[model samples]
Target: MSIKKSPESWAPNADQDLGPVLILEPEEGKNFWQPQPANGHISVRISPDFLDVQTPFSLGTQTLPAGGYVREHSHPEHDEVLHFIRGTGKAVVDGEEHAIVPGKTIFVGRNRRHMFVNSSQDELHWVWFIQPNGLEHFFEEIGREMVVGGEDPTPFPRPENVLEIEARTAFAPQPADQRKPD
Candidate 1:
C-alpha cells in the first residue's frame, strides 16, 4: 500500500530523500528467534528492506531468555547501539564487561567483538540498532521464523548455512581473524 501524496498529504522530502518515518510498538515488527541454546528473539522495528527504501540504520529489539546469550560476533562494516529495556544481564564489548540494565546504552564500533550474557534468572530484553544495514537480515536468516503473536517454534539447531549467511551479511568472520573457521 503506497501512500499517495496530495496537496495536504506528504512524501519523502527532496532535500532529505530518505525512507518514511516509522512508529512501531514493542511487538509491532517481524520477529525471529534462536532455536535451542540462545533462545534469543529479534524483533525488527525498521530497516531499509522493511521500509522499502534505503535507510542509514535499522532498529530492533532483542530478548534473551534466562541463561541465553548472544554469541560474540562483530559487524566489520557497521556500527551498533544497544539499549537495555528490561531484565538483567552483562554485555561484553571488545572484551570489556558492562552491566546491562534498563536505560543503559552501549555503543559498539565496527569489528568489535561483543556478546550478551543473561546472568539473572529473569529474561533479558533490549533494543539494538545497527547502521548501514545487515543485522536485520542476519537475524532473519539465522533464526527460525516467528510470527508477531504466534507460539514459539520447536527447538532446532542453527542452520548449516549460518556461517555463509554471516559472511554475506558483513559479520566479521568467527575469531575475528581466520577467514575460514574450522
Candidate 2:
C-alpha cells in the first residue's frame, strides 16, 4: 500500500530552508475528519490529523452549542488537551469537577473517564488535541461529529485484530461449545 500525501503535507526537502517556525491560522476550507454524533451534542470543525509523528496526534477547534452536554466518555489509547477559547463550561474528570473557560487548559489522561457540560448561553469554542490517534479513523469512517446527549459512546481500545477463536479461549465463559462447537 502507498501512503497518500496532502497538498499541505510537510516536505522534508523544505525543512532545512524554513528558518523559523511561525504560527498561522488553520486553513478555513481544509477538509477534516467528521465523526458520528454520539448523542444529541454536536461537534463542528473536527480535524483529527493536525500533526502526526510517532504517535498520531490531532488539534482542532470545536463548538458546543448552548446547553450542549457530552455524556460520560473515556479515551483508552490516547490523552487529550483541551484549551477553552470562548464561552464557559465544566468538565467532570474521574469524579472531580473542573471549571472550563477561555484561557483554561485541561489535560485528560488515557482511559480516564470524563464529560463536558456547557451551561453558558454562548457557544463553546475550544481547541482539542489528542495523542496517539484517538478515534481519528473511527470519526472518519462514520462522518459528521459524534453528538451524544443522553448516551455514553465510550469504547475500549481496539487493537488491529483479535480472532474470535482466540478471544473465546483467552476469556472466561467459553461459548464456543454451547454454540455447536467447531
By lDDT, who's the top model here? Answer: 1
Task: Write down the lDDT of every candidate, Cα atoms only.
Answer: 0.77, 0.52
At residue 33, give the lDDT of candidate 2: 26
The residue pairs that clash in candidate 1, if any, are none
lDDT of 1 by residue, 51-143 (tens): 665556888888888887777888888999998989998888777788888899999999888888898899898888898788888888878
Please give, for residues 43-158, the per-residue lDDT of candidate 2 as tens digits. 32333343224445655566666666554566656788888888887888777778888999999887677777777887777777777544444433333334333333433222
Cα-based TM-score, every candidate? 0.82, 0.55
Worst 10 residues of 1 by lDDT: 1-10
What local lDDT score does residue 15 receive in model 2, on the 0 to 100 scale? Answer: 46
